[model samples]
Target: MEIRARGARRPYRSYRTLIAAACAALLGVLLTPAGAQGAPRGPHGAVKVSQPVYSYADSVRESVWVDTGLDGDADGVSDRVVADIIRPAEPARQGRKIPVIMDASPYYSCCGRGNESQRKTYDADGTPLSFPLHYDNYFVPRGYAFVAVDLAGTSRSDGCADVGGPSDVRSAKAVVDWLNGRGRAYTTRTGTTRVQAGWTNGRTGMIGKSYDGTIANGVAATGVRGLETIVPISAISSWYDYYFQQGAPLQGSGPDWLANYVESPAARARCQVVQRRLVDEAPRTGDVTALWEARDYVKNAGRVTASVFAVHGTQDLNVRTKHLGQWWDALADAGVERKIWLSQTGHVDPFDFRRAEWVDALHRWFDHYLLGYDNGIERAPMADIERAPGQWSTDRVWPPRGTDTTTLRPAQGPVAGVGTLGRTAARPGTTATFTDDPRLDEEDWAETADLNTPDKSGFVTRPLSHDLRLSGSSTVTVTATPSTETAHLSAVLVDLGPDTIRDYNAPGEGITTLTERTCWGPSTPTDSSCYRETAPRTADVTHTVLSRGWADLGTYASASHGRPLTPGTRYTLTIDLAATDHVVPAGHRLALIVAGTDRGLIQPPSTTPTLTLDLARTSAHLPLVGGARAFTRATTGAAPTDPAAGRSRPDGVAEPRRTPPIPGESG
Candidate 1:
């Protein structure tokens, strides 16, 4: 493992120029004077650092059917998942093996991938003519094979889509096994003509966004042998968390709905039974069942041997932030080598927001992990975070280094309409109550902070003298008495002030695509490395919802099942809000809004129950970057009057759907 000189690198004007330079350098060192093609070599015989000496236009493109052990579609034979491959022709022709980069997805034939909504295009002989995204274009020319896998029951694959279940995971895992010479694969769907992945050196890296990335996480959790690393961008670690918040369902649709949406037209009739099972197993009660356990990757994190490069957005309401929060923590506990990038956008790919940097970082990560290059990427900062729109920062670890929990309790304010939040707790017997209102939401509560709203109780702190940074998730604990047997509670943490921030509610979800294109790799007749550039969309707002969470009072003791509560009986419910990294500027106040039925975010309970909170026992535990001392200093200033009364609505849509919308689908 020899270290390369980082300062010797320079940015090329175009990918073609970079490829030409790499070829000249390689030819000067290893190839014959006649320029005859041979096995790809890097100074020594090792596939250490990747160089674009291979031709993307001349890459070998083909497809194979990897057999999965399970028959998810109830067919007599085993299911065979399709893997569309594009690799450098030189290495394979000369009998020299290369590593692989795979993106196993259910979206290839349905919703498509990336900002351009590009799907896989095949030629007449069933060979892939154009693979979606730039992975094939860039990595294929850099001595790596790019595998675009269609998940079981989707696209040209056999079996049924299980929505992150065993079939979905096993379908992708089998491909890795086949590349390592363990699993069986065939050249045709029904034919017995066998195929072997002799071109691969058995080192693989998986990468994708959303559902595709979720597959990467699932496969990595299986501890597959050939997989060396994974890059899961805004992916889900647990399917239950995606559709449910604690014991409450976030939306009406379940995993069955998503399964149907991505199921191929040819397999719809055969996968009907699978869809029915998804519905039967996942009830509206949001209980943790065996079906959900199988889909949860975090629980099996200990088995993962692959290194991880996780990317997620803090404001992503579709897949939500808890997925990354929990998954990152699990990976850390298991002592897995990892890196992270946290953006300020909503359910967006990094390629759409930070293209050049993303490509370079991904290339370096794959080179170091899969190609076994000692490029010092692993020794660099572990976390790269977007502090503001277009503003970035790096740290050795996430949540900063010295983050600690700081508890803030609510007390009576000078004004009778609102409450005060500070280090001191309220009087022993003091209490505040709010009734359930299905129509109101976090936005409505944020607007009426100075008013006495019947549906919500607002608590605000005095004007801060210094900026206070919150680095991670916060917990809201409420000792409350419910008016009914069942109830729903929602807690929101808001930064009450005027500021300009990313417009995450916009049509593009914080990115405006431009007509100008940037080419990343070589081009062919149908497939090209060019894609539209994007700019960040920003908005001026009076306040921003930092984090929020929901909980079912009936399931206060257990998330597995609901136990009916006695009317008027006091019980403590702890709500874990989504993870966030935000700074409350000086002079702006921080507010906590506690309400029932946060309208579009979660489904309301059948019975509207009023909750009376014992203020002395209720508190919010915030993960503050500077801990309690910094908070005390920031809040030492004299109290100010309540914020101005106005609409103060933020830009973008009020509520994001459970699943992000596809190009032609309704949100």
Candidate 2:
């Protein structure tokens, strides 16, 4: 492509300039005019980011890269470049010393780089994942300037990636120095802040999700001086516990992900180092202590000098959801300002959020901490929304000091609707079960294991006749018996639809999908609760969310709240099935499905533990919203022929019944 600057006499000369300019063009979308705050969608109904540039100062253009010897990534970009400065944007606010927010993330390969493109086609409808952001951008905009830096040896930078090791730690620090440096350096005809803050006012912070988040936490542990505040969302604290040994062989995600995004020298050379060893070695169960200790974030959590606002989805199988407790404790012990937000959200995405909001929040945080701007971040809630019973709440701490854990039970048979091969329950006398490998052919190894399905039979309280907002963490415990190696369980709290419920986001696209459907993927945590550890385990999988926290800055309690289940209206709490979303209304069954293997879903850990399940004493402990009763009758989102049968849930008392686990033999 012939390249030219916005104002130039000739085409741009350097590829560095070209790439930086393109990134400036792309990442600069945060500059869009302030009036339209909601997510902008294209004609196809996907997120649309508008570009709005304020000033073009050419004097600040300069390149800041230090060559780190071990170049695992051979791309023209240096290892130090990848690890240090992937996409460094200049301070937007003149001499005010705006806070610098830098984050590193694993990029999906666009052209043979091990990076996996969840959003391959720019089209919203066709993309496997949505949005233009790497990972930090998904929610960073609520209050921060998100700088997505590729770790060493990954993309267009240099050196081999250390996957959160010391090399990565030092490189991350180098980038931090570059961000705060107010010193002078080379300038380009093109107005891009490639160099010099040049010396910063010591207002620097690191934030990121997943892999990026892992590094953010690691660097924080090193007691990096320049590193200030951090928001490590869905971080991989205990790598082995969360990545591999959690309960599966090959830990489907880490392997498939490395295969798709971090596989080799060319891939490594193209950017930074390939994660050759991190994802290469197969995880050996019962022997994961070595790996876990190696990746132990808690080891350094206490040493981290920077204050942190940590958030984790209860259902994040990819990361140890329990890390929140440890990280929080470490921060507290270190006397570092600390905060926590846990939710029934998943490794998927936190609802009640828009990209811009996330960006805005991170900005406010950096401004307040890094640049010393009193952005009011500290005044906001310290902890909030592990799950709202129809409305959102803000607290000073996680699991808030005075909060109580309530229980909601399953009162009906687990299965009723779709019985496999004509059987409703796996009766004691019959062999009833579904094989996972047979269904593996249809699974998406990338995200399925972290989020899979075990045939579940359950029900929700009757839907409310009126709309009720429910936002918070949720966990469902099932005493299931599996003849096979394991029993995978998935839970979803669907808004019994047909009632007008509105949130933001477009349809079909990745991020949009969460907002598009009245139904949500299992936004619960997969922990000791979600997964019972007894030989014939009775695991309780809990997932939760805290929308209001420093990590997630400008949040209104209302962001996650949606209409609650209508009174007396029937709603179904589905357990196992393909990923699907739609409205289940009042007067209809709040359907809950339980099964063995689901299409396109990787099964949970398969360690043979055949056992019987008990029901009478079992129930989901949830914060039921007051003023709303169990749905008396529920409406199904099925198309009807009759004109009078309106698609609306009927209101009444909510009552959910749980049936005995179909006692069946392993066929």
Write model 1 residue lDDT over 455-513, tens digit each, in one string.
98888888887777788789999889999988889989999988777787666667787
RMSD of 2: 17.4
By lDDT, the best candidate is: 1
What is the C-alpha local distance difference test score of each model? 0.81, 0.38
TM-score of model 2 (CA atoms): 0.52
RMSD, one per candidate, in order: 10.1, 17.4
- Location of the lowest summed lDDT over 10 successive residues in candidate 1: 1-10
> How many Å off is the CA of 457 in candidate 1?
1.3
lDDT of 2 by residue, 521-612 (tens): 11111100010000110122121111110000001112111122222222222221111112233232232322333332233443422223
**Candidate 2's error at 485, in angstroms?**
5.1
lDDT of 1 at 487: 88
